[model samples]
Target chain A: MKAIFNKKITFVIIGLLGMVLAVTVSGCKVNEAISSKTGAQLWGENCRRCHNAPDPNTFSPEQWKTVGMHMQTRALITNVERDKIVAFLQQ
Target chain B: MKQYITIITIALLTSTFAKAQTKDTIEVQKIGDKYYVIVDHPKVDTTKQFAPAPAPPPTISKTFDSHFMVVGLATIGFLNTWSVNKVNTPTGVVSTKLPTTNSFGDVAHYEFSPMFLWRHSDNILVEFEPSFSNGSLGVNWADITYFAYPGVILRAGYIVLPFGTYNKRLAAGWICKLPTDPVSITSSPVGSDWGIELEGGQQTGKMKVNYDVALTNGFTLSATDGSIANPDVNAVDNNLGKTVTGRFGWLPALNSGVEIGASGLWGKAGDANTAYKNVSTAMGALDFQWVYAKKPVAINIKAEADMQYVTNASYSNPNPPTVSDTTYTYKNLSYGYYGMFSIRPIVADKFFRNVEFAVRYSSYQSPKGSAFENRQDQISAGVCYWINWRTVFKIGYENLITTNPDNNELAITNLKNTQNILYVQFSVQF
Candidate 1:
């Protein structure tokens, strides 16, 4: 019974580590996709002159939520564009 | 087999009851014509999420600050030490050595000097100078200076003494260029006593305008008991009298590829006596300097001429009562002009170091009625190695030639005038 309990604990630890690794890898992919799209849009509109394309991974999701408000003043992105950007970053 | 089937049936029933209890609860009751029911379940959606925003950028502002004074003080201290140690030998030696030292040395015997200066702001600066040499006590050289603006500065303190154009040796070069008769007995260290001076100046671009006016209360030339009187001429009582002097100069550009400037000074020495006829003398001089250089390498040329006129000089002897009063005059006295061309080249870039090679020529006619009236000239060549902005080491060789008067009126006849000098100097600003 004690040996069975020890095996259970080892399985739980491995599972937790696997979950963390999966989240980190997915976060990086999502950040890369978001940054590429943002860069393309910014370059197309000549917005790069004033501000560089935002790197999603540079700030956490909570920080990005507030930054989105300030970006709207002159960024002039539609709701659909904003939603797409967020979705890409959160992927 | 029957027992096993019964146990399985019981376990299945128990599990079914537990499942029904854990399921969402709902109640229904039949009324006259309709049915009413109550239900319970988890309330809201659990999938939604939110994130926080980023912080704002920082700001910048402006304010005044102080610079470190330690470095400046250290520099000043080093220069004082260097000047004192370099000139110690000459201050003690009475050798018939050639005037290998600069003209400034001939003018006033300089002892070791330590000077401290502080500039609290752009508008205020003060300085203190004390000198010691030849077993003599330290003396105050200068102490006061005030600035009203970048272009104008006011000074009130012990000013540099001015007597003959050749006086104030510090202002002169390290060595006299002219050869002198070995036999003539001339006064050594020819500066006048200290006095008050007022000076104002303006500088712009490469040009500078300066004016100085000075007055001496009185100074004893020598003590009756043979002591090295203080450079502060007013240290003794009998040597009290007012001296008036003025100097002006204009330099268009100091660091330009080529630079030129001319300076002039006029001064008067009041009576040496109180009741009897006071010895009054007036002296004037003009100097021109030119330099050609490009940053690290340059050549400098300087030339100056001085003249003096004396009046109301008198002497009395107790043996003669009927001899009433008589006056003596010495006029048209002139000191020959000297010129030097110095070549300086940067020797080290790391420390802003340089090496200087200079050749000088000086000639002056002795005062009339003073035993030695003949003229003399000397030539000197020296090299100076600048260790840094505030330190230098110098070595020089000088040759002297004198023209003796046929009348033999002076103390000594023909003499050899030549000497070698090695000196090192360090200066700092604090």
Candidate 2:
């Protein structure tokens, strides 16, 4: 009876440690996704010439609405590319 | 009981090993996002151990060209012509022979002049001037201006000071129109005196002001003394002086695009003859300009009234008083005033840019105490054609009327009434 009780206690401790490790590892994965620099690298390769580094304060929300409409003709940026560029600028 | 305990322990150890392996795999995937690094534990910090990616090399743009060249010259001419005919005493007959005695007479002549200018940027400018006439090689005014800024320009060399628009355009040919009341038209045009000048000014809103400060050597005021037979005694040189002139202009929003301005000049005239002291003169002027345009047709108007006051003038003869005894004393105070108007109307708009019809009127008065107190009026109508941006060809007919006061010392009992003049001029610039 004593041996069985010891085995059960050991199993419970092992299970709790497994759960804690999984939670910690999952947290780290989420942090890495948020901090990745892939978007920055893509921007530097594609668009750093005529268009200066994106400045968020240059346009207000209302101004950005108008700017997005004309961005295709002025900057030659497609809709998908414009959206990504805008997101990076906002960030 | 011991066997049951061993089996449970084995199961727990197996489960713990599997969980640890699964957690290590998850941490490896997380580290892969950074730089494909594999980590075996969640608690391990890889930030300091990871090396940053190298920065990319700078790229050069394709459209980069960097080379340019510019080159330019300015020429000015000051011509003075005097044609004097002697008159027989009793019969009052005019002769081309040189007069022996000092007598009041009439002189008429024409002057042709040209100025060439070239400039390369604001750093350097070269000027050449040639004045041609049937009589003698005329005078030339040449200068180079180095602009330090838009407001300040430094000029070195010789120049003819144009105190007014008329002085700038007409006086090069006609000197009798000197706008002083006590007129002295008989000076020399070696008005091409050497000088250094600094002209600077600013324009703000409707007001503009400019100041010209010049230091001169061998400067003369009037060419009236040309009548003196002995060129040695009459001709003067090697004089030193300075002149400060200020011009202020205002453009009011009224009067149909008219611009009005006033200018004042004060300076000391160096005594070319050492026996006499230097004289000081004060001059003032008022000017008005107007512009009118009808689509392709345009007209420009400029009018000016100029006055000069001369004091402390003394006559001196260097040739041991040959002409007159006791040093030829004369009254010092002199004044002159004149009004002039120029009208330019565009005649052709398409091919010829400056082809225009122009008419000008001028009237002058000399003061009583001066040797030349003659009232002269002129009416001129002309056509001007522009060859380029800075060159022009002018042909004109002028009708001149002269009246000397009955009590004037210079005017004879009877003088010629009206004189008609026809002139053609070609001017070029670079």
Candidate 3:
């Protein structure tokens, strides 16, 4: 019975894996044109999905410059978009 | 039993402070010939490394980080809730029960932790992470920070003395992968205390170097007989020599995904009543964290090694001076180390990509006459199912081994030799 249970779980996980793949492939398209979005909108759209976004005023402007550079790579954001987001939060 | 109760009580009290004040208040006081202004500053440097990737874009209608970027995080939903529940089953424990629990099928931890951050402005911030577990409350730390500049940050109030990643990151339930933290971490001389600290970081070539220096009230050793002579973390310095602690780390560029750190703390532990007037304690540690990700596979590794020493230590019933004619002084040494590795197969994508496998090994040995004087080893293997980036469910198995002491000083039989247990936990941050 334990073996059968394990097999059932394996099958269920495999089935779910297929669904996730389909969604991910669909999500691979280019992001929507973001020219109209403000820095706050970019920050909201980019930074708030995984964990709660920290207050932008949490660090100095120089600190944000460094943090922005570091996060650009971590968050996989374009340099232009990161600059906009950092500029919005650097107050 | 007394220590257990005391620990639980402290945990409970600490948890209540998680609701930190959000209002920004400025007080100007004339002290003799000088004027002082106390204000809030919300600032933190990337000193500890492991910069959080931007969480997935907010799905909720309200984005806490975005809506209040101008007013500060405190005005929005800065008071976030974190919770964890653990269940354990002990197997092959013949003579004694586990230190965390006695029977199988017992709930090891049911904890609610609240993190409050009040970022008043670009220059000032107040933050606290407090937790309540099984009716016991504890405050991890609470402090008001001032960002004097990009290179200097001054903090006052009860501060979590910087030592390693565990002291800084473990309070957040969603981040720590294990149900319980390593004994080497919690048992060390690291905890929240009344302290003032200056910490900052600077980029040097390819490495970002960060430093933290602090002066705080140190611990004192109890001289009573039949009681634990462990160093008591006091709010006030017992002696004139205040404890000094520092941590320095090097992050080899964010893209490298590696951080290495070393920390040390030293202070006089003697009070007025002790025969040895200048007894002292010192501890040093080395720690590292590294992450490697390539498409389908992501690996995370962390390790730490630390040693502690106490000068002129005495373990005597009632009074140590009475036990010996001369000032009998002994030097006590203790050491501990741990390493952990975790891997996630990202090839599966989305829900499947959230599954992670992890393993950890830890060991500790203390002086022969201290309260926890045994040599212990623990190995844990676990799997985590991430419902999202901020919530997870975990199941694990732990194999614990220890050397039985001549005297059962700790009184728990489960810590005598070898014990095996199954562990499971559910943790989330809202």
Separate DockQ for every predicted complex = 0.01, 0.00, 0.02
lDDT for each residue of candidate 1 in B152-254, tens digit (9 for 90 to 100): 3455666554332233321312222222211111322234445565444333323333344456643222211111122444454344445455444443443
Model 3 Cα lDDT, one tens digit per residue, B1-430:
9999999999887765543344344567554455656554344222333333445655754312211121111001111112222222265334543354333223334566665655556556666656665355666567777767544568887777776656764435466666556767755667767789877654343335556677887766555321113233334566677777777666654343677777777666677565645666677789887776678887778888988876645554322334344333333778898898888886855776878888988888876555546787888788888876567777777776766454333232323556666666777654
For each candidate in turn, the TM-score is 0.48, 0.48, 0.62
Output DockQ, candidate 1: 0.01
Model 2, span B1-430: residue lDDT tens: 9999999999999999999888776333323335455565668775655666556656853321221121112222222222333334466655453323211111223334554444434244445465554355544556776656544556776654534433433343321111111112222121345567655433333223333444554334442321111112124443454554444444343222455655555555545565433554455567666555555565556677766554444443333224354232343333333333333344455445446666666666655434554566666676666554344556666665565544323333333345555545544422
Model 2 score (lDDT):
0.43
| Best lDDT among the predictions, by candidate number | 3
True contacts kept of 3: 0.00
Q: Write the per-residue lDDT of candidate 2 for residues A4-79, one digit (tens) a residue.
A: 5335534543443343344323433222332242445424422321121334555543333333322322222223
CAPRI-style grade of the A/B interface in model 3: incorrect
Position B109, candidate 1: lDDT: 32
Candidate 3: stretches off by over 4 Å = A1-91, B1-108, B225-235, B253-256, B317-330, B369-372, B407-415
A-chain TM-score, model 3:
0.61
Candidate 3 global CA lDDT score = 0.59
